[model samples]
Target: MNNYNLNHLKELESEAIYVLREVASQFQNPAILFSGGKDSIILTHLALKAFYPAKIPFPLVHIDTGHNFPETIKFRDDIVDRLGARLIVGSVQNTINDGKVREESGRDASRNALQTVTLLDAIEENKIDCAIGGARRDEEKSRAKERFFSHRDEFGQWNPKHQRAELWNLFNGRMNSGEHFRAFPISNWTEMDVWQYILSEGIDVPSLYIAHNREVVWRNNTWLPYSDLIKLRPEEEIVEKLVRFRTLGDITITGAIESGADSLTKVVVEVASSRQTERGNRSDDKRSETSMEDRKRLGYF
Candidate 1:
């Protein structure tokens, strides 16, 4: 039984590695979107395994929202240094300063939605034909519509209706000039599968995922961390709590959950018994039922 479970992970790993290799072979200018999130971390690890003994041919791209957790940034830099890989950062702050995107207003304002413009800008600026992302189909409804090679139109908009069919394990990276593809190497991976694989491989993840004491405020039915970017409501009060983030994004919108799972093994156990999805804490998705799908159409990742 243990061997069977191990082989399941090996199969997923093989599929991800094959997809990464396909991206390298098919695209002239391909880059992996590295957000320092667990999914992206796993993607980077698979890319390394896919091209062992040779330096990864593609660069790592980050769409910096200027609102990320400091630990995420630190982890990103450390990983890049360890890998000896090139990193390209697209700043959402720069996009705002350049009048390309406007920041939202009020206490609920977040830079989460503004990352799309920066991502598109980076892809165009870098001439990236294929942008490999760590998005998984099980994470959200919009992501479920994605193929192994998700196509983006000339304007970087995703039209689910126009997506090409992937028969068998075959993928078509062909696209017209001015258009590009958003490839998801681990599209079929589930949250449990990711955690199990991480444990099996002994991969390191950001510490924010582990339970710790932090000052947070109750907002939007989740524990919103106290950050300078967040505007405190008149009724809201800051209080320290044992919390951990399931998904990391702009700190303003990424909420934490009360947890006692301080270690990876405990985290895996917690995930198994939890009823809510990992993304349940993310406030951005709470805006609407189709919020993620809407964003994808507008070129948001």
Candidate 2:
């Protein structure tokens, strides 16, 4: 116990930096999945710090559901431009137009589940051998079992039970042709750690996290934002509420929590004291007990 004086945050930062460097050194065509979310922003910032004086080695990949928040899109483009990194968008609209996937019909239907197809399409089209994401173990039970270097089959399907052993950070990145890997540099990080890291690093994120007044409707025990994709019920009346998004996704599925935590410190405090998980706001995951698992098996991230 005497030698445990090292800061845990610093240790996590070191590990993430190591993982970033490993991706650069190992993969031929790698890219970071940037969604303009807080986690992605932190991941991108760490990548820049990992290779200072040298630009990020890989491009940024975003699977646009065509239902993202306007602020998120603006922030995404701004970050890419500032970082001088290439941005590739895999649009769900293109997938629908090409008949690759059909749009869901219903008030609860969302494009969140459909993102996997666009993501896989982007990977194949770009010939990307590795995709670094901001996925964290604490976000969901399925993600808890993920490795820092999670391998995917030729079809981009994940086999949790058959995953390769990662002992003492000795990652085995070997994979056959047509097979790629999803690397989570911040796999061990928790929501609290993410907020703390963002505060420490002064990373910029979308304004949706901060409290703002918006016209919302109470549905499915969560506050659903008013969107063209959402169908209104006669009983569910829209009202102005001070709310903030805990997690960003397809506008129809992502829920907002009533909050007044406008600043980063306040946000961190809120997360630290909250009893519910971050994904609690994601209606897509609420559809089934194994929703995330089922989606991940089909190449969802």
Candidate 3:
């Protein structure tokens, strides 16, 4: 009668909870960046767990790309309302209107790049000293170099080489005026780790994560959802497929994976034995070899 071995997941949970609490205690105005994606959902769940019996002290910030999936937006609103957490939307469209950013023009252009400006503008406008996110080092090579408490300059830009030495779990969140930090709670967790944790905790995510029938087109080595944001080229044709999204954002660029992992158990199994990286289906990252690094350097969620 001695076969309980969920300690690994428990440890990860504890570490994330500790980071969330640290963010709350150290930053004056901190907000969790909620993207309605798998990672961000886990962050929200951890925040709730960290401050149970008391409401989450920080608000949830969503940088709206205007090209989001309808389901993702609905799920975001529902989660915020259910949690009674304040929601702030940094609209890329509004940033465009303010002349703070410009909309890219092309069949392949997406608001993914424009989101950086909107996110940084939001930080400046809201005076958010620290922004918490759910990025993991194992997700991509660029993020692998990120620190638990990453610093940003006054312009919201990050010099990868200038990153402070983070050794022995000693995080230095202190920053000068007009500068801020981006804290990642589950920065050490991997894709399989996330799925396993979600499975163990029964955390609910958007339906798109589960297999479903949707109109999609094959392009750029992945299935692209049919949406108003996309103007299908002549070479592409829509067909119904039982597919699910591995990542989400700027519907125009997000890609879907062909799968039948509808249940959490099935999804965990799929993730456990999958060959592709979770971010493999993301067209945004596939834009160039240094796409993610370039974006993270500029400012991102």
Candidate 4:
């Protein structure tokens, strides 16, 4: 090892920047999946730093489940406007109307699973061969098996067992026609790494991550954000609670935790000693032991 001081966060940033550039050089049409989440915000920040004088070469693709938080959508639009990056939205509701995927039924109904169809459709419609996502290995068990350059079949399905070997920083993005890649620049970064980077870089994330008073309902062992999309069960009455979301997604499925960490400093402390995974509140993953894997196989990011 070199005798110089080692800064892990800076090292991670450098690696992510290198991966972003690699995607730019390798793919014909590449886009970043931006959701105004902390991870994607970091991706955007790095992309800005990577190619400073030039505008971001790729567009930002958002797959609208139609259940997104109002704050998230507003932040997304604001960032795209500020950065002058092109935005592409693929609507799950449109996919449903087109008879591609149907909405779920019963009390456990959610549009979370239907997002895969919209994502695949968006990739096909936009002719995007490479999609840069803000997926971290520490976020989920299934994601822990991902590569920096993850391969997808012609149908956009992922076979986790059959991944390309990224040895010594040499990434192989070779794919046949109709095939594409899901490249994760920060796959190696942990939750703490992201928090530290955000704090250090002073990046802005959506307001949901910070603790605030919101009307929520207790469901499926977690606090569900109150929204028009969430049908209030007779017994499930909405109550005001001070909560924050660990992960952001469809209002019906994404779960929130009771927190008092209002600032970034408090958030760092909260994340440091947290016993559960960052995605522990995501009810979509609670469907089964291999739910994430199953979704990934079906082309869910």
Candidate 5:
């Protein structure tokens, strides 16, 4: 007889893989939300592994806020091409031009909030029944209460309190017409677990994660990337600094921290010793304590 004991991380990976298979086996028009971020990249890799001997069964969707790093866009295109997966992009700029959303006017204004409208529009236009995301519970307080198969109403709104109870790995994917599901395959993984898994699996990530010298401005207590979209107040000044992005988002709001962690091993060590949450670098969440929760209620992913 053979005996096997799975570690916690392996158990999580197995569970995520099972969820990926379930999405493929259940949904009719499923799509994976791929932003080329570490979380999404890991999810894509896991999906590939889950369906070994066959290409991913779903298309890749990117809700483009029009403020992403060039490296992230390049990585997104490259991965989609390599995997032969279809890519769908919903542009926020288009939404603003069409008057579907309004662009904010301020020194720190960002299109991050407007991305929700574009994302929902994309889902409706593409008729995507299920959107698989890489959102993890540890990322935010509200996200911690998310289910593996999170249901969304016809308007794509999330009711956190009314979520179905998941028991014994059974998921109730039943939904009414026009309603959809937001599936999170890696909902239980934490930042440290993600870094450790990336290191262990030798996953390829964007160069922005590694320490590099770039022109940045001090804003909101973190170094903001110097970009045309980034407004500079009279007090703010740009300077060259050694920085790396902990989480990639709109250039106007995403913060980079001073780091020398250039490799996956170094990154894992840094994450293990870090005190701040990964979303700490994201300025959108800084708007309010329940910002993410409110956004989720309003149909934001």
Candidate 6:
């Protein structure tokens, strides 16, 4: 007797594809919350594979914080153009201008938390009943509380205890009017799984993930890229270093780590042995132990 079974990566891929198809079948309007990061890129790739021979049914929606790395924006546009996919961008700056939110001020200032309002507004404006994302439970404690299909109330609030139960690959997307769902196809994947799959599948990620020389400064225990949003104290000097980001977000809040893993194989190997979670470098999450959970309650992806 010959035994045939899917490998570990294939199992994760199958689960993600199943979740994507379920989102399509369960919701009237759906979208992918693309951030030009590796996770979102992988989500888009899996979505493409899920409905091959036909264009992805839903559009890609990005909540632009107006503080992104230039390389990220370029990569986002190039991939969208290549896929001929519809792109909708909700600007945080615009939201700030409209008095919907205020930009944080001071030396530790960042617009990272402000993304919640913009994301919520975007959801309502687009009438998106379900927003598909690439968040993984292994990323953080708050994220660990997430279900495959997370429901948001009419005001876009998430109550973890009140979320519907998911069992045996069965998802319940039932919700009242004015409510929506946040579907995570890759909810169970870990950082290691993502990198290994990316390597195996030959998926292209932004150049920021590869080690390269860039101007950075030490801040909040990590190397932060020099950008207009940051204020350098007199003692802080901008120095060049070979670094790579494990996660991508607004340049103001996202931090990079010194690394020599310039290739995908090296990245996967590095990830396998690393002790810190990828988001450990992010300054926003350091604000509080529950910072991510707090943001989630306010509709931040």
Model 4 worst lDDT run, 10 consecutive residues? 1-10
lDDT of 3 at 105: 88
TM-score of each: 0.97, 0.97, 0.96, 0.97, 0.98, 0.99
Best by TM-score: 6
Q: Is candidate 2 or candidate 6 better by lDDT?
A: 6
lDDT of 4 at 24: 95
In order, how many clashes per candidate? 0, 0, 0, 0, 0, 0
> Roughly what TM-score does model 1 have, to 2 decimal places?
0.97
Tens digits of lDDT, candidate 1, 1-301: 4544547788999999999999999999999999999999999999999999898889999999999899999999999999999999999999999998899987678898999999999999999999999999999998888999988999999998877889999999998999999999999999999999999899999999999999999999999999897778799999999999998888888889999999999999999999999999898998999999999999987
Model 2 lDDT, residue 186, Cα:
94
For model 5, the stretches where C-alpha displacement exceeds 4 angstroms are: none
Question: Can you write out model 6's per-residue Cα lDDT over 135-225, one digit (the tens) per residue?
Answer: 9999999999899999999989999777787889999999899999999999989999999999999999998999999999998899999
Q: With candidate 2 superimposed using the best TM-score fit, by how many Å does residue 149's alpha carbon deviate from the native?
A: 0.6
Worst 10 residues of 6 by lDDT: 158-167
Write one digit per residue (lDDT tens) for candidate 2, span 95-125: 9999999998876778888899999999999
- Greater lDDT among 1 and 4 belongs to 1
**lDDT scores of the candidates, listed in order:** 0.93, 0.91, 0.90, 0.91, 0.90, 0.93
Of models 1 and 5, which has the larger lDDT?
Answer: 1
lDDT of 4 by residue, 1-301 (tens): 6788659998899999999999999999999998778889999999998888899899999999888899999999999999999999999999999998888999888999899889999999999999999999987889988999999999999988877777899999998999999999999899899988989889988879999999999999999989888888898899999999888888888889999999998999999999999888888898899999999999999
The weakest ten consecutive residues by lDDT in model 1 span 1-10
